[model samples]
Target: MTLNRQWLLKARPHGMIGPDNFEYTETPIPQIGDGEVLVKNQYLSFDPTQRNWMVDRPGYLPPVGIGEVMRAGSVAEVVESKHPDFKPGEQVQTTGCWQDFAVVAPGQGPMGVNKLPPGVSPEMMLSILGITGMTAYFGLLDHGQPEDGETVLVSGAAGATGSVVGQIAKLKGCRTIGIAGGEKKCAWLTDVAKFDGAIDYKSEDVSERIGALCPNKWDIFFDNVAGPILEAALNHLNLYSRVVMCGGIANYNNIEPVPGPNNLMNIVTNRGRMQGFIILDYLPRAMEAIEALVGWVSAGDIVYEVDIQEGFDNIPSTLQRLYTGENFGKQLLRI
Candidate 1:
């Protein structure tokens, strides 16, 4: 009897996504005929891949087809149910897309989200427990593997994954240096996240500041914003250093391809290892990450910074903020 509002892709965006690229419509609520439970979405996640995946080309994941709901992962409360495993009032995580409601099957999605434990809010689940958290945990632990006394450099350090990556490095006894867009973000990174040092990319010479921050050379780099930042980090990479390339927000909106990194010579000189990572591969370790992440959150060792935008209709604008480096931290939608 209810209508579900879903944002469908209208046209593919070449550089940056905008409101015009989507078509929002009110459609009949999907019938939960068998094992499916209908959910009223409470929160949704916005990510950079929405841009990366829509190029009509093949990559690690498939592109979002025209007329399909703009793809997103969401946490919602079950409003109606036909499945015994999921009852009304229960919360779950599913591929909800940019919609006000969804009907998801049991034993589906990254993991069943029928119930969430206490102390983990919907924001925490979608962020720390979802893609952003996994990106930080797997990207740093698996690739960076920063050691005690090491100098760790994290680009986009004031945002979601970079904040956690720097904090995790700090917890492991490494000196964390952050690169963010402004002085405010830089201050938050050092003061709140406990990063040993930071660089405001807007006001300072990133490469020079990094050199001054750590004369020892950066031993591990968790790079979220690539392009020039990646180039800058290369100048300070230590011998056998590791670079975890998570996303390249700077180049996401470029009409032309970002020039090949200008500092490849440093990689050859330092014998550093540059690599890319995706959180999907680390799903099995979700519980392990939650246990550790929760401990940090409760102990005040880890801070969760979320930039929440209200309503499903605002998703496009919210998404554009990620590419502009305008969002201060973890980005999400409050449905």
Candidate 2:
């Protein structure tokens, strides 16, 4: 019998998640019931949203209760199947938790297990073609609504979603500015991702730089790292600007209540629209976004990067990179 190694949530995180928050153990691989399939997990996705799932609170999906498998999206190859819908040798994507194997059932909806398309590598499906890409695509186009020659600014700009948002804005004929930490990330944004400007938020004065770079103010602000950066962007929103509220990695680990942006009055003053979105809300239209993204990637109109960590043992420490800004591009684990 295959031994399944799993990470169980041992305690709710008090601040930043630590090794003590999770307990790893080995057990027999789960047997598939009548409609279930057994998947051998190969890649585990590390996302900022997983932090929210760790807290015991209501979210788009219910929080992972204590002692449950640490919830995560993963790509797996089906090794055994009792379900008619799944076949052996097929690769699938699902919330496989932090484990070597997963037992999955279909019809979970929005967040269900499904077969990966042919020719799409596991890394591509998890990064640019997966939830990360979809979030950037729909959030920027549907909500940001950037126009030709308009200035679009994105926080967490070197990350998986934010990077894509900047590129998509550029493709739409908008001038793009990316806000990221460190000179290296900023350079990657302007030099590699091809954004019009890149701000090193860690080293430079963000509001002052925004004032200088975008004298007309930003037409769209796709905010992923919410904190001071959100406030800074809010202070410079142009008339009818749209703010797409994505992940808030800066505040995800805060034990104490964080304050709202003091400059939110700019939203009222400029008649700007700020909206938060859960990507699951756009699931029905995911195929539309996927087709466009695939086409863009195919034609060299879009590019992406992935940071792959090697060991399953490093999952906890790897996740902390999201909060610490140590991770560049889309963070993933090769199990």
Candidate 3:
């Protein structure tokens, strides 16, 4: 009785992605079997990781095969259900892909479908309360291990995850410094997120700016941009400092092998630690982070932004925004 519009990956990308990489199709809405719930997706979460999913590579999760539906996370409402745990009208989160609807089955592979909390809007759920928030929470607290009065540096600081990481660092009493691409975003970091300092990477010499701002050396380096930014931070690490390798968006689309950070020896010189983490590892304790984040949001200690693009037709083009650095915060497609 319904139609489902879907986007299928038509080809693997060599450089920047475009509409030609996908095949759009429409079919009857999927019917739910026993132990399954039919979801009418409300909001589609656009994340940089979705790019990796499109490639054929060895990674944390298997790559989406050719001609397969592109994978993505979304917030949805159960319109029909046969599962005991889910009921009609309940809002849930699942890997709804680039589609108008999804059939969520129980024990859905890692990041299984789950019910959302009460009273929180879908925007908040997809932004600060969802995977982006959890990534920031765990990446900073559990991995970075920031200390009070210490200096914390965050690359890609105006992004969804980076913004939250900077705020959490500030709330922990650390001096937070953000590295962004332009004057407006840098200003937002300093003026709005209240970062102790912001460096406009597009205009300033990263190494020089960081050397001046963190004269005492940095205690925690949240490396999201990686590459040259990671190298710049490496040149200024304090003894026993912690580096949280959250992401490397700078080279996610690179076809040729990108070289490692040039200042790799700094870790040994400063006797500091550098480690990477995948948020999926902390799924068992996600609610703890979610509750703390919720409390922070409720108390006005933490704030976030969402850059929403309308229509499912724009998913491919909209995703390119993350690569071009055109998206302001959490990028979401309003379905």
Candidate 4:
């Protein structure tokens, strides 16, 4: 506990990320300044967007500098506080990075620092009620603007964000169809998450399945996996449909830039709208999403999965799960 163990970005990734992309070392536990707090990260969040953050390019946030701690979201316990609003032993969520300890302050970093609500576990705060949940809530309801009886399609539908998107669409009286990787995930989507139908993109013809599933065409496409899947969804857009661009995990590891969907004209022809969003833009109104999500989850209307990998040694390898389809849901590392 005297030193902070960290995974630093060693080199920018070329294709798929691996252990070599990061360097591990120990440093003195960071000291907190006045109005800052020192937190011991208990869990680390692994996200597809982290791949984008690793590249040396302009993004919503700055890339992790070489030899610097790799940035990540985490649920942590306050170990020491120089800030008046925080106290020791309280659990909070913040941009704790890939380190055992971090110095954080209120209204700092992309996530900033917020206390976990009463009766909310760290896992719940990081997964269903965290970034992914918020993304699903705002992306589908706010951006997609789904209506009753509309056919709602979701890509990456078994992942943290997409699963919730489909469920919320269902709650809003939309017919939900999910596109996931394998039979296992697709089954979970239809059987457990209660989607109207599911398309296993790995085994089935996605465009054909969409046609079968949405006989009337889809009204909203909440896309998390863009690439060929995006093109497929675009092919089946209903008139004046909405496409919520959330994540593009399909091409995140590509060495060369992947081509955009060739069928984007479908949007224009159908008079549809496609909009991309960054969850950070809605952070100020986070509680709005959290409140609604908590109600659904408590009432069993929404169900989410979290894949927790243990031990600090497994940190780098655990992240590879997101791109490799090894993770079933929200990927987190227990420190």
Candidate with top lDDT is 4
lDDT tens per residue, model 3, 82-167: 99999999999888888988898777855789898888888998899888899999999999998899999999999999999999
Clashes of each: 1, 0, 0, 0
Ranking by TM-score: 4, 2, 3, 1
Report the C-alpha displacement of residue 130, candidate 1, in angstroms.
2.1
Give one digit per residue, the lDDT tens place, for model 2 in 69-145. Answer: 89899999999998998999999988788999888888663467878877889999899988899999999999998
lDDT of each: 0.84, 0.90, 0.90, 0.95
Give a tens-digit lDDT track for model 4, residues 1-335. Answer: 57899999999999999999999999998778899999999999999999999999999999888888999999999999999999999999999999999999998899889999999999999999999999999999999998999999999999999999999999999999999999899999999999999999999999999999999999999999999999999989999999999999999999999999999898899999999999999998999999999999999999999999999889999999999999999999999
Q: What is the full ranking by lDDT, best candidate first?
A: 4, 2, 3, 1
Q: Which ten residues in a row have the lowest lDDT in candidate 2?
A: 105-114
Report lDDT (Cα) of residue 154, candidate 3: 96
Q: Which residue pairs overlap in candidate 4's backbone?
A: none
When summed lDDT is taken over every stretch of 10 residues in candidate 3, the lowest stretch is: 105-114
Candidate 1: segments with Cα more than 4 A from true spot: 107-114
Error of 2 at 257 (Å): 0.8
Q: For each candidate, C-alpha RMSD in Å?
A: 1.5, 1.0, 1.0, 0.7
Global lDDT for candidate 1?
Answer: 0.84
Which residue pairs show backbone clashes in model 3? none
Give the candidate number with the greatest TM-score.
4
**Residue clash pairs of candidate 1:** 92-113
Report the poorest 10 consecutive residues by lDDT, candidate 4.
Answer: 1-10
